[model samples]
Target: MLSLQDYSARDALDLAGLVRSGEVTAAEVRQTALVAAASVESRLAAFTEGPFEQLPAHSSGEFAGVPFVIKDLLITAVGVCGHGGSAALADAAPAEADSTLMRRFRAAGLGLLGTTKSSEFGLSVAADQKWRGPTRNPWDPQRSPGGSSGGSAALVAAGVVPVAHANDGAGSIRIPAAHTGLVGLKPSRGRVPLGPWQQELMYGNVVEFAVTRTVRDTAYLLDLVQGNAPGEKYGAPLPAEPYRDEIADRSPRQLRIAVAAHGWDGQALSPDVRNAIELTASTLADLGHVVEEASPAVDWEGFLAALTTTWCAGTAAAVVPLLKSGTDRDLFEATTVTCAEVGQALNPVDLAVAFDQYNALSQSFGSFHAQWDLWVTPTSVGPAPAIGDFDADNPQYTAAEWVRRCVVPYPTCATSNVTGGPAITLPLAQTADGLPLGVQLSADLYREDIVLRTAAQLERALPWAGRRPVVHVTTETRQR
Candidate 1:
């Protein structure tokens, strides 16, 4: 009598193993996931629609029979119209077929549960919505869960699922994972396919991946979903073997790790975040890895400006179509409006110059990676902020001022996006108040397997899987 509620109690691997061992069936897992999703939906508002039907049929893969959720921004079920957290496209039609990623997800045996919420157009760092309201932190409903993958992170951290799909353009995945104490990895650009639509979004900076409870799950999914689809402009070189095999073979090789307590913009890292970095560095050193404080020289101002230009340009492109359809006028958030306006002001020459500068920054990092095997830094400058911290409606500060205050330690996690490198944020530390702190580990481009293997080693060394949030589903509630 394994009911729908029990799915939330175990990780994806556990559920899959249960099915394989005859302890439970795939249907039981899906039912449990749906029940768990229903229980948390109202309080967290993580999903935009039903805890939808399972995949029509299980396929052949490691995670076969496991249940999961996809972020609404990514296409999943046909005719399941996704708003991307925007009311402007509220009437948008469901996609006619599965996106390439969705096809792979199904082939690998992950039962699609439903779609999660995202910031409007995946622009904002906070997942607040003018129509659906905010996706509250399961740990502390008053605080943010982080965005634009806020809803995905919330559900995963709240124990609603073992893992869920999350994409990052600028810290969307890592920020939420840091806030909620989950493992978030932003794969090297082109490592995951984006097809039947476009190759890269946000000018080659954004990539899709999953936020998962375990390192192996992230590695497994990457192996399955990464490849150039029919029309993709580029793809990463395939690994000689599966990523799951890499995780299992733990080689204790000494790795040269460069550590930076300060952010890319040279902003002072908060004591808590700095301490987390220092602690992780020490742990690495103890593990026989060569660790030292160092970072390649970076032109922070130029990098930040270029990032803004690229982001604004993408924003403009997205909104222009909506405006033509008379849909642009419906955007609810003030920041979304401001972003579009800023984007429209840029000319072709300005965009070209920005692209050139981005290239220069990436080259500089390439030179640095020639010296170090990995670079370690704090995932964020400080701990998570309270709700409404980045509210665009607040008149206390202009949009520019708001972005400055909200995105402290400018280019902390965003640097990897600029460099197109593989990075992972591990929940290795916690604040005095019990909020999780993350340490970021980045490797050369296309070296995600190395980064993941390193993460798996550290996961074993630190053993963070046992650390549960103070605010979580109670046994009494789970029993219900």
Candidate 2:
């Protein structure tokens, strides 16, 4: 019998090695992953379904024979429904064939386990679900794991899988990574293919990637999945070589690094988060990287207003089909309803204004990047809030206010989304309360190699993959 702890932290390369050395067969890996998934699914609520069989044949790619899970938002293997964490689409059928992304993942040798949970329509930052119940933080079940990639984070943090697919529109990847202590890279927009049905950019901010414990795993996946699919609207230019090479030769030239612990929109950061940022700055300075305090020039209020408008419009776009199908009655949470309504209220003029503001913010960020090679900040304003911290039922504060206060580090992440730059969150520091506190490192557009190279250096300086969540499937539990 395979140990769940050993399986959880084992990188894709290690799993491949296990298969190569005859230490474990691919079927054995599948069974072990299923066992681990079953043992933790009830307590963690990370998965939307139990163990799934009929995985594709192992490919000859680098990570061939490794078991993994995809977030329910993205289409995956046949017969899997991408409920997108909503009751309305609970019975949705699988696509006739694999999505372009899924084909690439399969080609790279990953065994599909099952779909993981995501926030309804990938909206709220909290992973708590109205239908399936909240996906608890493995660090502390009472706290939020962060969403809409919450399930992926929980499973990885809880040691269910080494890595799982995650996407970011409004900091989905980074937020959950911050909450759960993992390495999350939100690649430059258009870095990966989104195919078959959709073409032109959806919302102009969303980008998909995976969250992993090791920096090398992320770099390897990025190298594998990044390129233009046959019918992709556009593709980000490829790096000179694979990103995997960047991790091995990880020394980025001493960079001009800017540190900002507080939110760009003026929200105060918690002391623990602030200290993490300060510590990161000190570490970079010790490494001979120049560090300074800087704020990019932009109309902060206008930028945020534009983002809200665009986000609401996107929400409205998503809600229209459900409403037309008379399925709005089945929507999971009230917050989703409110956001969709806000989206519906906006007219063409509102959308145009938002687009113009986005362009302006992009230019503003470009100017800031011109001054510095990298920007370092805390991934969130505070540590992971308790599960109910962003409760939609709260009458004391409006939903918008709650989102703003809870996601104070959004500006640090939102800029990358709007500008199509690469941003990475590293689990290099921890809070006094023993919660993981992540630091955000971002670079100019298409400089993912730089961002990842820096992450590799930090990973070596302050190793974090060994730090597993307390509530994980151990050998003792597996015996049962």
Candidate 3:
């Protein structure tokens, strides 16, 4: 039998190796994960559906028998409830079939144990949904684990699972991972299929992925799931080599890395976050990489306009079907309803212009990347914020205002999503009070290799494995 402490200490790859050696049976590892999840879940509130009673049978893939959970949005598994954190869909029938990504997870030997909570319609940066009470950070219970993917991040950070599903339309994956001290990579747009149901989510602005505690876990997972489904409308160029191979070398090539300590619009960051960026810049330079102070020159106003348009329009598309199905608008949060209303008012031309802005921003970032191999910035403006910081249910805010508020503090994440590039957040820095402060590393389209190599290099330079949250499975004390 694998003890809970042993299970919590090992990454997914390690556990898989253990099972392969027959030191622990697959059932024993699953039971250990379930017990660890139970130990911390009361304080973390990290699941929409807790551990499944009828777990999937073990497989013989790369990560065979590793416990995993899916987010309650975008992706689906057959017979699983995916409400996307909305009360209205609580009674909706389970999915009839597995999604493309879900299929890949099973084929790769991951045990599908449960689904985690998400923000309503994946619209908010904080997951304190009015319908489903807040999901707390493992590091600090009073603060959030960052949202839409907050539940997944919390569970992984608390040692419930080594990694869990997370998606990013506008910082959902990276924001949560950054706050919770995990590695979150938003793959190049179209690198992973949005498939059988969606051709492209939010016109390629949204991407599906996961948050993990190590770069190797992220890399290996990407290697397993990165590809196009048959007849896909869009696809990123195939990687030159397996992403896991890219990071295995550990020694990154010396390159020009751009560093930014402030928001793209020159917004102020917390002193601790700013210092972390400076320290990371120095550290990268120490590792023999050429680091300098620079950021891509972006048209801030144009970018925001496009973000507002696409995000609202996407929300409208998802929610209007339910609205027309005669589901009461009252069943939704106020922000969701208002976003649909605003989106309904827009004509096709509005979306066309928004796409145009996305093209221009991509070109501008492309030109900038021609000079710099990577762009590094603070993942969020500061450490994890309190749970109630961004109220998704507030009716007072209009659609545009809501988008602005969400992006203002965590500005860097959406840039890669809009540009169709790859970006990752590394848990390299921390606040004096011990909360993690993630730093963002991004590259031009289809250049995940650069991001991962640099991320692996940094992980070695500043190790984060010794730190554990008070609510973690390895911790004896569980705070509520």
Candidate 4:
């Protein structure tokens, strides 16, 4: 019998192959995940609830029963209520039906294990939510796991499952992955469906995807879910070939890569993150790729303004639907109310101006790509901050103050979100105290394959699977 210790030893693809080969049943894998979730629930604060019941296997699906967790935000499950971490919407019924993306996840043979917590309205960066508390970092439980996808990242990092569903609007996937030592690939906007409930979100800024332990899992999942649903407002440029196949083909991976060593907003990277990126740049050079210092020229301040515009506007729309009275507004944080008001006060002329700036920012990256194949940078300015560093709900600070504090560690992240490019964060180093450190590789629009190839090469050069966090389910890690 395979002991529980053996269950988390492999990534999802490895387990799925075993499940398909009859060496282990799908139910066994799910039970292992559930036990892992239960074992570390208090310490890590990952999922709100999980239903690990075995589902009938589908012969056509690639995963064929691999256990998976979707974020309790935009995506819905049959019995799982997707409250999206809002107090006002707590009683919202279980989704009448799964979203189109969820249907694809199921069609690909992934078993629905449960739903993970999300930051309220997917608005905050830190994991803390009034609804589910914080999704504690497995690397160090007292520290924060970046969100709104923090719960999903925490579960995968702690070995509850090989991968989990996560969506990125403004660094939610990559930020959490960087903090937790996982591979977070934010595909170009429109690369994955956001539909059946929404055709576009935040003016095409949010993209749905997963964070995983291996490049292959990221690639495979991309292949599994890469397309537009019927009547999607837009679709990504279709891949020339499946992403996994692009990885397996291993075409010569030499190209000019632009590397930025400082924050866009003048925030200097901490020594640890600085060292990691410099080392990564040198390694890329050694791997036969040309490395140079460069970044796309864009209006950073204007980009921020537009992001605020769309985010606040979208929040207003989402929250307004759930509000029935003035008291119902109490169910949300003060920042939420302020953002909605600001968003609601905007006119079409104001929105048009912001969209124009957004498009200009996107084009700046487009022109820069003509000179470089990808851009490399430190994923964060420092190791994970302590949990209370970004208290969006705190009345002591305004919403803008909270957002500024939250983004200081990740000033460059939102640029990619606005530009609609593909960015991947990889764990290649650790802090002096053993916290994970990540270096990001961002490729131009529609070039996810380039980033994947670059990441795969780096993964081989500096393998991270053997390195384990201290707060793992298999064995509790001693905190520093």
TM-score of each: 0.95, 0.95, 0.98, 0.96
Candidate 3 accuracy as lDDT:
0.89
Please name the candidate that would achieve the greatest lDDT relative to the true structure. 3
Q: How does model 1 score by TM-score?
A: 0.95
Show pairs that collide, candidate 3: none
Across 259-330, the per-residue lDDT of candidate 2 in tens digits comes to: 887866677877888888888888888878899998677787777777777776777788776887788555
Where in model 4 is the C-alpha error above 4 Å? 54-60, 249-251, 324-327, 476-480
Most TM-score-accurate candidate: 3
TM-score-best of 1 and 3: 3
**In candidate 1, what are the lDDT values of residues 1-480, reduced to their tens digit?**
465335555778877788888898777777766667767666788887768764448666768778778887855567677887888878778888888888888887887777888888787777777767888887777887888898889888877778888899888889899888889999988888877677778888888889998898888888888877778876788877788887784565788999988865677877888888888999999988999989988777776678777777787788877877677565656666676677888898988888888888889889989989999988887777677776754535444554454455434678788788999999999888888888889988998877888888888888677666644544325545
lDDT of 4 at 450: 91
Clashes of 2: 0
Model 3 residue 36 lDDT?
82
Global local distance difference test of model 2? 0.80
Error of 2 at 111 (Å): 0.7
Looking at model 3, residue 67 earns an lDDT score of 94
Q: What digit string (tens of lDDT, one per residue) describes model 3 on residues 154-217?
A: 9998888998999999899999999999999999988988878888877788899999999999
Q: Taking the tens digit of each residue's C-alpha lDDT, what string does model 4 give over 140-221? A: 8888888889999988888888889999888889999999999999998888988788888877888899999999999998
